[model samples]
Each structure stands twice: as structure tokens, then as C-alpha cells.
Target: MTQLETAMAILMKTFDTYAAADGNKGSLSKGEAKTMLEKELPGLLKAAKNQAEVDKLLGGLDFNGDSEVDFSEFVVLVAALTCACHGRCKK
Candidate 1:
């Protein structure tokens, strides 16, 4: 697989690994989501600087207001972070 394909696969695997913890294979419970972030994106949480920024970032992902994050929501978070990082580097 190409780099992008590998990255996507990793994302799927990571999301699955976290989501499976709560026995709800389709979406992550809040605890699952928190564990996923703490384990998979430690840097992101640190970079956030404060609780509000972290809250704002995570809050943005719940577009459907279901309180659980599905695969689409997980992917959007990664993509948004990537875009934010890329834009910063380009500046």
C-alpha cells in the first residue's frame, strides 16, 4: 500500500482497537474516545495548551450529537488536525 493507504489503514485499526473496548463495534463511547486520544494522540492533547481548547476540538467532532464518535467522526478529527498542522508549517 502507498503511504496514504497505510495511514488510512492505521487509522481504521486504531479506531477499531479503541472502539472494541466498549463492545460497541460501530462507535466509541466517551471513555473509549478519551482512552484513544490519550494513547494515540498524546501530542495533540499537549499542544492544546488548556482544557477549553481540547474540549473545543473534541466538541467539534460530535456533529450528530449522539455523544459517541463513529468512524467518520474519528477520521474527520485526524484530517482536521493534519490540516491544522500543515497550515501552521506552511506559515
Candidate 2:
């Protein structure tokens, strides 16, 4: 697979791996989202100045107000972060 294809597959797999923890294979509950962020994006969490900032970030990701993050929402979060880090990661 191409690099983008592999990245997409990894995104799906990572989301599924976390979303399946509570038997909800389609979306992530708040706890699951927190766990996923804590484990998968520890640096991002650490960059937040406080717990409220991290909570706010996670809350903002739930665009539909459904209290759970679906795959599309998860993709938005990843895309936003990628954009935020785009130039910063360059050597």
C-alpha cells in the first residue's frame, strides 16, 4: 500500500482498537477518548497547560454533540493536529 493508504489503515485500526474497549465498535465514549488521547497522544496532552484545556480539546472534537466521537470526528482531530504540526515537524 501507499504511504497515505497505510496511514489511513492505521488510523482505522487505532480507532477500532480503542473504540472496541467498551463494546461500542462504532464510536468512542468519553472515557475511551480520554484513554486514547492519553495513550496515543501523550505529547499533545502534556502540551496542554491544564486538565481543563485537555478536557476542552476533547470536548471540541465531538462536533455533533453526541457525547461520543465517531470515526469522522476522530479523523478531524487527527487532521487538525497534523495541520497544526505540519511545519513544526520539519528538520
Query: What are the clash counts of all predictions, listed in order?
Result: 0, 0
Cα lDDT listed for each candidate: 0.85, 0.94
TM-score attained by model 1: 0.86
Model 1: weakest 10-residue lDDT segment is: 82-91
Pairs in steric clash, model 1: none
lDDT per residue as tens, model 2, 1-91: 9999999999999999999999999999999999999999999988999999989988998999999999999999998889778865342
Q: Which ten-residue region of model 2 has the weakest summed lDDT?
A: 82-91
TM-score of each: 0.86, 0.93
Superposition error at 42 for model 1 (Å): 0.7
Error of 2 at 91 (Å): 22
Among these predictions, the greatest lDDT belongs to 2
Model 1 lDDT per residue over 1-81, tens place:
999899989999999999999789999887788788888889988887898886776667787999888999998888877
